[model samples]
Target: MDDKEMLFNSGILTEEREGAILPPEELWKNKKGGLVVVECPQRIPCNPCATSCPTGAIRPFSDINDTPSVDHSKCTGCTLCVASCPGLACFVIDLTFSDDLALYKLPYEMLPLPVKGEKVLCLDREGKCIAEGTVENITQPRKDRTYVIHVSAPKNLVREFRAIRVVK
Candidate 1:
Protein backbone atom coordinates (compact mmCIF):
# COMPACT_ATOMS: atom_id res chain seq x y z
CA MET A 1 0.00 0.00 0.00
CA ASP A 2 1.08 3.60 -0.64
CA ASP A 3 2.17 5.93 2.14
CA LYS A 4 -1.07 7.86 1.86
CA GLU A 5 -3.13 4.73 2.08
CA MET A 6 -1.15 3.48 5.04
CA LEU A 7 -1.58 6.82 6.76
CA PHE A 8 -5.29 6.84 6.03
CA ASN A 9 -5.85 3.30 7.21
CA SER A 10 -3.54 2.57 10.10
CA GLY A 11 -2.12 5.80 11.49
CA ILE A 12 -4.95 8.26 11.11
CA LEU A 13 -7.22 8.32 14.16
CA THR A 14 -11.00 8.25 14.18
CA GLU A 15 -13.71 7.41 16.71
CA GLU A 16 -13.41 3.76 15.79
CA ARG A 17 -9.64 3.93 15.80
CA GLU A 18 -9.62 5.67 19.17
CA GLY A 19 -11.91 3.04 20.58
CA ALA A 20 -9.65 0.30 19.31
CA ILE A 21 -6.19 1.77 19.83
CA LEU A 22 -6.41 4.58 22.40
CA PRO A 23 -7.11 4.20 26.06
CA PRO A 24 -10.73 4.48 27.14
CA GLU A 25 -12.43 7.89 27.45
CA GLU A 26 -12.62 7.39 31.20
CA LEU A 27 -8.84 7.30 31.29
CA TRP A 28 -8.67 10.64 29.52
CA LYS A 29 -11.60 11.98 31.52
CA ASN A 30 -9.99 11.15 34.84
CA LYS A 31 -7.11 13.40 33.91
CA LYS A 32 -9.12 16.39 32.80
CA GLY A 33 -6.34 18.86 33.43
CA GLY A 34 -3.61 17.64 31.10
CA LEU A 35 -1.89 14.49 29.85
CA VAL A 36 0.04 12.80 27.05
CA VAL A 37 -1.59 10.57 24.44
CA VAL A 38 0.59 8.17 22.48
CA GLU A 39 -1.07 7.31 19.14
CA CYS A 40 1.60 4.81 18.14
CA PRO A 41 -0.16 2.03 16.18
CA GLN A 42 2.53 -0.14 14.56
CA ARG A 43 4.55 -2.09 17.07
CA ILE A 44 7.98 -0.93 15.90
CA PRO A 45 11.00 -1.40 18.12
CA CYS A 46 10.89 1.89 19.92
CA ASN A 47 11.18 2.83 23.58
CA PRO A 48 12.10 6.49 23.55
CA CYS A 49 8.71 7.47 24.91
CA ALA A 50 9.27 5.29 27.92
CA THR A 51 12.92 6.29 28.24
CA SER A 52 12.46 10.03 27.83
CA CYS A 53 9.71 10.36 30.41
CA PRO A 54 11.31 11.57 33.63
CA THR A 55 8.11 11.01 35.57
CA GLY A 56 7.86 7.34 34.67
CA ALA A 57 4.45 8.09 33.24
CA ILE A 58 5.04 5.67 30.38
CA ARG A 59 4.95 2.16 31.68
CA PRO A 60 8.09 0.07 31.24
CA PHE A 61 8.21 -2.97 29.03
CA SER A 62 10.55 -5.93 28.62
CA ASP A 63 10.58 -5.45 24.86
CA ILE A 64 11.57 -2.19 23.22
CA ASN A 65 8.91 -2.72 20.55
CA ASP A 66 6.08 -2.62 23.05
CA THR A 67 3.54 0.14 22.51
CA PRO A 68 3.46 2.81 25.21
CA SER A 69 0.60 2.95 27.67
CA VAL A 70 0.49 6.19 29.60
CA ASP A 71 -0.08 6.66 33.30
CA HIS A 72 -1.91 9.94 32.89
CA SER A 73 -1.86 10.57 36.62
CA LYS A 74 1.92 10.67 36.53
CA CYS A 75 2.39 12.66 33.32
CA THR A 76 3.24 16.27 34.06
CA GLY A 77 2.60 17.33 30.50
CA CYS A 78 6.24 18.39 30.28
CA THR A 79 6.38 17.18 26.66
CA LEU A 80 9.66 15.26 26.93
CA CYS A 81 8.11 12.15 25.37
CA VAL A 82 6.53 14.14 22.57
CA ALA A 83 9.93 15.18 21.24
CA SER A 84 11.49 11.81 21.85
CA CYS A 85 8.87 9.97 19.78
CA PRO A 86 10.41 9.28 16.35
CA GLY A 87 7.04 8.56 14.75
CA LEU A 88 5.74 11.98 15.82
CA ALA A 89 2.70 10.23 17.23
CA CYS A 90 2.77 11.65 20.74
CA PHE A 91 0.54 14.53 21.82
CA VAL A 92 -0.16 16.55 24.96
CA ILE A 93 -3.60 17.93 25.72
CA ASP A 94 -4.49 20.46 28.40
CA LEU A 95 -8.19 20.58 29.07
CA THR A 96 -8.22 22.96 32.01
CA PHE A 97 -6.02 25.68 30.64
CA SER A 98 -9.04 27.81 29.81
CA ASP A 99 -12.77 27.63 30.12
CA ASP A 100 -13.35 28.06 26.40
CA LEU A 101 -10.32 26.31 24.92
CA ALA A 102 -8.00 23.40 25.25
CA LEU A 103 -4.26 23.46 24.57
CA TYR A 104 -2.80 20.91 22.17
CA LYS A 105 0.92 20.30 21.80
CA LEU A 106 2.64 18.13 19.19
CA PRO A 107 5.95 17.68 17.41
CA TYR A 108 6.41 20.08 14.51
CA GLU A 109 9.47 19.48 12.31
CA MET A 110 8.47 21.51 9.27
CA LEU A 111 10.52 24.53 8.26
CA PRO A 112 9.60 28.23 8.47
CA LEU A 113 8.26 27.85 11.96
CA PRO A 114 5.41 30.03 13.10
CA VAL A 115 5.84 32.49 15.96
CA LYS A 116 3.78 32.95 19.11
CA GLY A 117 0.27 34.33 18.56
CA GLU A 118 0.44 33.45 14.87
CA LYS A 119 -2.73 31.97 13.46
CA VAL A 120 -2.47 28.59 11.75
CA LEU A 121 -4.77 25.99 10.32
CA CYS A 122 -5.54 23.12 12.67
CA LEU A 123 -5.75 19.76 10.92
CA ASP A 124 -7.35 16.45 11.80
CA ARG A 125 -5.57 13.11 11.72
CA GLU A 126 -6.33 12.82 7.99
CA GLY A 127 -4.57 16.18 7.43
CA LYS A 128 -7.86 17.89 6.70
CA CYS A 129 -8.28 21.43 7.95
CA ILE A 130 -10.81 21.48 10.76
CA ALA A 131 -10.31 24.78 12.53
CA GLU A 132 -8.21 27.91 12.70
CA GLY A 133 -5.91 27.68 15.68
CA THR A 134 -3.52 30.13 17.21
CA VAL A 135 0.08 29.33 17.96
CA GLU A 136 0.44 29.87 21.67
CA ASN A 137 4.06 28.78 21.97
CA ILE A 138 7.00 27.12 20.18
CA THR A 139 9.87 25.56 22.09
CA GLN A 140 12.96 24.64 20.09
CA PRO A 141 16.31 23.95 21.61
CA ARG A 142 19.56 24.09 19.68
CA LYS A 143 20.01 20.40 20.39
CA ASP A 144 16.53 19.39 19.17
CA ARG A 145 15.33 20.35 15.70
CA THR A 146 11.90 18.88 16.26
CA TYR A 147 10.13 21.84 17.81
CA VAL A 148 7.13 21.41 20.10
CA ILE A 149 4.22 23.57 19.03
CA HIS A 150 1.44 24.50 21.50
CA VAL A 151 -1.83 25.52 19.94
CA SER A 152 -5.23 26.52 21.35
CA ALA A 153 -8.49 25.62 19.66
CA PRO A 154 -12.09 25.06 20.58
CA LYS A 155 -12.38 22.62 23.45
CA ASN A 156 -14.46 20.31 21.26
CA LEU A 157 -11.73 20.10 18.66
CA VAL A 158 -9.14 18.90 21.11
CA ARG A 159 -9.46 15.33 19.90
CA GLU A 160 -10.28 16.24 16.31
CA PHE A 161 -7.30 18.45 15.52
CA ARG A 162 -3.95 16.79 15.86
CA ALA A 163 -1.74 18.97 13.64
CA ILE A 164 -1.20 22.49 12.43
CA ARG A 165 -0.21 24.04 9.10
CA VAL A 166 1.61 27.33 8.85
CA VAL A 167 0.91 29.16 5.61
CA LYS A 168 3.84 30.91 4.01
Candidate 2:
Protein backbone atom coordinates (compact mmCIF):
# COMPACT_ATOMS: atom_id res chain seq x y z
CA MET A 1 0.00 0.00 0.00
CA ASP A 2 1.11 3.55 -0.62
CA ASP A 3 1.80 6.14 2.10
CA LYS A 4 -1.42 8.08 1.60
CA GLU A 5 -3.41 4.87 1.80
CA MET A 6 -1.54 3.80 4.89
CA LEU A 7 -2.09 7.18 6.49
CA PHE A 8 -5.79 7.12 5.66
CA ASN A 9 -6.20 3.54 6.83
CA SER A 10 -4.62 4.59 10.07
CA GLY A 11 -7.15 7.41 10.36
CA ILE A 12 -4.98 10.17 8.94
CA LEU A 13 -7.82 11.42 6.78
CA THR A 14 -10.15 12.05 9.68
CA GLU A 15 -13.88 12.53 9.56
CA GLU A 16 -14.23 16.29 9.44
CA ARG A 17 -17.65 17.72 10.02
CA GLU A 18 -16.40 20.76 8.18
CA GLY A 19 -13.22 22.77 7.50
CA ALA A 20 -12.73 23.32 11.23
CA ILE A 21 -10.64 20.14 11.59
CA LEU A 22 -7.18 19.36 10.37
CA PRO A 23 -6.85 16.22 8.21
CA PRO A 24 -4.01 13.73 8.59
CA GLU A 25 -1.89 13.81 11.66
CA GLU A 26 -4.51 15.73 13.69
CA LEU A 27 -7.57 13.55 14.03
CA TRP A 28 -9.09 12.67 17.39
CA LYS A 29 -7.42 9.51 18.73
CA ASN A 30 -10.86 8.19 19.50
CA LYS A 31 -14.40 9.47 19.10
CA LYS A 32 -13.86 11.03 22.50
CA GLY A 33 -10.47 12.44 21.64
CA GLY A 34 -9.57 16.12 21.96
CA LEU A 35 -9.62 18.15 18.73
CA VAL A 36 -7.97 21.30 17.35
CA VAL A 37 -10.20 22.90 14.76
CA VAL A 38 -8.20 25.05 12.33
CA GLU A 39 -10.26 27.54 10.31
CA CYS A 40 -7.56 29.04 8.13
CA PRO A 41 -9.30 29.79 4.83
CA GLN A 42 -6.32 30.30 2.55
CA ARG A 43 -3.63 27.73 1.71
CA ILE A 44 -1.14 29.91 -0.09
CA PRO A 45 2.65 29.66 0.05
CA CYS A 46 3.40 28.56 3.58
CA ASN A 47 5.75 25.84 4.84
CA PRO A 48 7.89 26.97 7.75
CA CYS A 49 5.71 25.55 10.54
CA ALA A 50 5.43 22.05 9.07
CA THR A 51 9.10 22.00 8.11
CA SER A 52 10.14 22.97 11.64
CA CYS A 53 8.38 20.11 13.39
CA PRO A 54 10.95 17.91 15.23
CA THR A 55 8.74 14.80 15.29
CA GLY A 56 7.57 15.13 11.70
CA ALA A 57 4.24 14.55 13.42
CA ILE A 58 3.17 17.18 10.89
CA ARG A 59 3.23 16.35 7.19
CA PRO A 60 4.99 19.01 5.12
CA PHE A 61 5.14 16.44 2.34
CA SER A 62 4.99 17.80 -1.20
CA ASP A 63 3.95 21.25 -2.20
CA ILE A 64 3.95 24.12 0.28
CA ASN A 65 0.58 25.01 -1.13
CA ASP A 66 -0.84 21.87 0.41
CA THR A 67 -2.40 22.31 3.81
CA PRO A 68 -0.22 21.07 6.66
CA SER A 69 -1.61 18.14 8.61
CA VAL A 70 -0.92 16.45 11.94
CA ASP A 71 -0.45 12.85 13.11
CA HIS A 72 -2.02 12.70 16.58
CA SER A 73 -0.32 9.41 17.47
CA LYS A 74 3.08 10.77 16.58
CA CYS A 75 2.24 14.22 17.87
CA THR A 76 3.18 14.75 21.49
CA GLY A 77 1.00 17.83 21.54
CA CYS A 78 4.29 19.59 22.14
CA THR A 79 2.94 22.69 20.41
CA LEU A 80 5.96 22.82 18.11
CA CYS A 81 3.63 23.06 15.16
CA VAL A 82 1.83 25.76 17.07
CA ALA A 83 4.95 27.88 17.09
CA SER A 84 6.17 26.93 13.64
CA CYS A 85 3.10 27.69 11.62
CA PRO A 86 3.77 30.82 9.57
CA GLY A 87 0.11 31.38 9.01
CA LEU A 88 -0.35 30.51 12.67
CA ALA A 89 -2.70 27.84 11.46
CA CYS A 90 -1.56 24.97 13.73
CA PHE A 91 -2.82 24.04 17.18
CA VAL A 92 -2.48 21.24 19.78
CA ILE A 93 -5.14 19.59 21.90
CA ASP A 94 -5.21 16.92 24.64
CA LEU A 95 -8.61 15.30 25.09
CA THR A 96 -7.65 11.81 26.17
CA PHE A 97 -8.04 12.05 29.94
CA SER A 98 -11.00 13.87 31.34
CA ASP A 99 -14.65 14.33 30.59
CA ASP A 100 -14.81 17.92 31.84
CA LEU A 101 -11.41 19.21 30.84
CA ALA A 102 -9.61 19.90 27.57
CA LEU A 103 -6.16 21.42 27.11
CA TYR A 104 -5.57 23.58 24.05
CA LYS A 105 -2.28 24.74 22.56
CA LEU A 106 -2.70 27.67 20.22
CA PRO A 107 -0.66 30.46 18.64
CA TYR A 108 -0.90 34.00 19.96
CA GLU A 109 0.86 37.02 18.47
CA MET A 110 -0.43 40.07 20.18
CA LEU A 111 0.13 42.51 22.95
CA PRO A 112 -0.79 41.81 26.57
CA LEU A 113 -1.13 38.07 26.20
CA PRO A 114 -3.09 36.38 28.91
CA VAL A 115 -0.96 35.31 31.82
CA LYS A 116 -0.64 31.71 32.92
CA GLY A 117 -3.02 32.21 35.80
CA GLU A 118 -5.61 34.24 33.98
CA LYS A 119 -8.92 32.68 33.03
CA VAL A 120 -10.61 33.37 29.73
CA LEU A 121 -13.74 32.30 27.94
CA CYS A 122 -13.20 29.56 25.40
CA LEU A 123 -14.36 30.43 21.92
CA ASP A 124 -15.28 28.42 18.84
CA ARG A 125 -14.24 28.86 15.19
CA GLU A 126 -16.75 31.68 14.84
CA GLY A 127 -15.29 33.62 17.78
CA LYS A 128 -17.95 32.79 20.30
CA CYS A 129 -16.83 31.41 23.63
CA ILE A 130 -18.71 28.26 24.35
CA ALA A 131 -17.17 27.84 27.79
CA GLU A 132 -14.82 29.36 30.32
CA GLY A 133 -11.19 28.31 30.82
CA THR A 134 -7.84 29.32 32.28
CA VAL A 135 -4.64 30.13 30.53
CA GLU A 136 -2.33 27.40 31.79
CA ASN A 137 0.87 28.74 30.23
CA ILE A 138 2.58 30.40 27.28
CA THR A 139 5.73 29.69 25.23
CA GLN A 140 7.32 32.02 22.72
CA PRO A 141 10.14 30.44 20.79
CA ARG A 142 12.57 32.77 19.03
CA LYS A 143 12.44 30.86 15.76
CA ASP A 144 8.71 31.20 15.46
CA ARG A 145 7.14 34.57 16.17
CA THR A 146 3.97 32.85 17.32
CA TYR A 147 3.46 32.52 21.04
CA VAL A 148 2.22 29.11 22.14
CA ILE A 149 -0.54 29.54 24.65
CA HIS A 150 -1.85 26.61 26.66
CA VAL A 151 -5.43 26.98 27.76
CA SER A 152 -7.45 24.62 29.95
CA ALA A 153 -11.17 24.52 29.29
CA PRO A 154 -14.14 22.21 29.45
CA LYS A 155 -13.51 18.85 27.77
CA ASN A 156 -16.75 19.01 25.89
CA LEU A 157 -15.58 22.24 24.30
CA VAL A 158 -12.37 20.67 22.95
CA ARG A 159 -13.58 20.61 19.39
CA GLU A 160 -14.50 24.27 19.54
CA PHE A 161 -11.39 26.04 20.86
CA ARG A 162 -9.82 27.30 17.67
CA ALA A 163 -8.70 30.92 18.16
CA ILE A 164 -8.48 33.25 21.06
CA ARG A 165 -9.09 36.90 19.93
CA VAL A 166 -6.07 37.67 17.82
CA VAL A 167 -4.43 37.45 14.43
CA LYS A 168 -1.05 35.97 13.57
User: Which candidate number would show the highest TM-score if scored against the true structure?
Assistant: 1
Candidate 1 per-residue lDDT over residues 20-51, each given as its tens digit: 44434665644654688788766788998898
The segments of candidate 1 whose C-alpha lies over 4 angstroms from its true place after superposition are 1-10, 19-33
**Clashes per model (N, Cα, C within 3 A):** 0, 4
Model 2 local distance difference test score: 0.63
The positional error of residue 143 in candidate 2, measured at the CA in angstroms, is 4.4
Q: Can you list the residue pairs that collide in candidate 2?
A: 25-70, 25-71, 26-70, 49-84
Give the C-alpha miss distance for residue 24 in model 2, angstroms. Answer: 9.0
Global fold similarity of model 1 (TM-score): 0.85
- Looking at candidate 2, the ten consecutive residues that score lowest on lDDT are 11-20
**What lDDT would each prediction earn against the true structure?**
0.78, 0.63
